[model samples]
Target: MGGFLSFVKKETLHIVRDRRTMMIALLMPVVQILLFGFALSTEINNIDFAVTSPNRTEAVRRQVERIAANPYFTFKGYIAPNEIDNALRSGRADAVAVFADDYDRQTAATERGEPAEKAVQLIFDASNPNNAAAGAGYMQSILLAGRQTGAAAPETRLLYNPQMKSAYNFVPGIMGLIFILICAMLTSVSIVREEETGTMEVLLVSPVRPIRIIFAKMIPYFLLSCLNLVSILLLARFVLGMPMSGSLAGLVGISLLYLMLALALGLLISTLANNQVTAMLISGMLLMLPIIMLSGMVFPIENMPGILQGVSCIIPARWYIEAVRKLMIEGVPFADVLREVLILAAMTAVLIGVALRKFNDKLE
Candidate 1:
């Protein structure tokens, strides 16, 4: 017990003495949270909308006023029908709404249960499909609200995230990204550094067993990564206004499994790499890109090409992100995320087994 405690203390002191490693493990997560929280967003707002009315009746003016009052849209003044194309082409407007001359009559007819021609024509610039789709939906809502009678209107309700805040989606993804990068990259580099400095041989020759030495090396990083995870969760809940609706214990358990997988992956890299620089390169260049691109962090996996979707299956971050989204945002039960949990557990076991075998072979 005394020897184990001394080894843990030695590893802890070594980590604390290294300023660069400390900054990467501590400061990087905070910076990434701030960057992703503020800058990265998918919610559409402040769209430039142009309107044209041929007759300019009081009813048309009233409808226009309602459209301008919407928070999502900024009215860009009325445009001529001929200028509609130019408005969209020049980026002067994201969409154009042309009211028919008989808009008032058509609306009144519809209210009286009479069949009427469509009262409005909405032309949108589909250059950005997401923005176009959201803008069109917003316009439709405005039109429906402007109607005098509510009897025939369809009621829409958004679940899970009613306001459609992008942070709700990004926070979990950023959590996965930070954990994987920090644990894997830092562990790999730390292990490789000992090899480069000829210290690994001294440790191997010590009274401690090889497996015990490896655990001693890993203990400090595991604790540090746990601290980082707690810090991220606090920021997400208190600072970013994202609430955890699921079981806290479940989240912690899943996160710990993911961290273990990351650490083992790093150990594997360290065994394969000849030096700290090579380990860093492999962790950053190889792992980071796949985590970001194929993990469904920024893009929906369903929207990707079939081949890319198949390729994304092997990326561990994908499962972690999906599990977090289900637990944190959707408030699903542990049973719902059992598949993700099993996959992560399997990954951790495989990585740890392979890494241990390689480390023992290297020692021999």
Candidate 2:
């Protein structure tokens, strides 16, 4: 009994002594609860709603006021018919309300000679099928609020995904998850495994600078990640029948940049981890959850709590998924993805710089 108790006590002390183990044992549950509490939401809120009226009649103007008064929407002011496409592409609006030129005259009762036109047109960015559907429902309730018996339902159209396919949303999200999994987690583990087995020191003994040496180790993984990228694109295009509406070259270029950023992120992770297991643990704990929850993959960021939404801005996968969705699904031009590209580039540069500075010369 004494020996058994001693063994248990020794193991307990070992776990308590290892900070990483302690964090996983004690803090992981805390993190999971917090994320689930604030980040897991399907309800649509804070939709950026815009209105476009070629002719602003009293009826159209009054319907616009009704939509504006709704708590669910952020009422972007009236835009031109020509500006609707640009507004959606530029993220200026989530859904646009378009009124026909003779809307008021057409909606006039046929008790006279006039025919009733459709009440309004709701154009959604539909990259997220769920959001598009929910936004349509919300707009319908608002537009047809008092006139449920009289008004014609709003004419709803989904941009980018007229079919409203869920596949269009998840494919890019899966690509983001896979790129980070292969490039960052695998690279981190491979480098840390070398450190664990002392092979890293051998490679570092060469005349080359240590940063270059460490990064050279990442070359094979980067190539492997590229192969995975090609595989995903092929499957997404051929098997899934997803449309590649934007510039294929632009998508490929941005994907390569994302892969590089993932590689740098791996190098940074390896610098922090002492052993292969720790590297994998840190990668899973830090990278996986954020990629799933905060990357805007399964959940809409705008629906999350303010702090988690802000934290999402720093998550590399969030920007990658957004860019991919824009190019792959929405068919936005390369210029339209400029903001995402710049943010990713800045993140890559920062991670690489930190990894080089933090990498220690001696194996401790």
The local distance difference test score of each candidate is: 0.88, 0.78
TM-score of candidate 1 relative to the true fold: 0.91
Residue-by-residue lDDT tens digits, candidate 1, 41-140? 7778889999988999998898889989988999999999999999999999999999999998999998898999999999999999989998999898
Where does candidate 2 stray beyond 4 Å? Answer: 1-151, 360-364
Measured by lDDT, the strongest candidate is 1
Name model 1 segments beyond 4 Å from true: 1-3, 148-151, 305-307
Error at 321, model 1, angstroms = 1.7
How does each model score on TM-score?
Answer: 0.91, 0.60
Output the number of the TM-score-best candidate. 1
Score residue 57 of candidate 2 by CA lDDT. 82
Cα lDDT tens digits, model 2, 1-364, are 4534443454345445756744543343334333433454445778998998888888888888888887778899999889999999999999999888887666666425466767578999999998999999889878776345444555567788786566667778777877787678877886788788986677567555566555556665576667667767776777667889998999999999999998888988998899988998988989988999999988899999999999999999999999999999988899999999999999999987887667753433
Q: Candidate 2: worst 10 consecutive residues by lDDT? A: 28-37
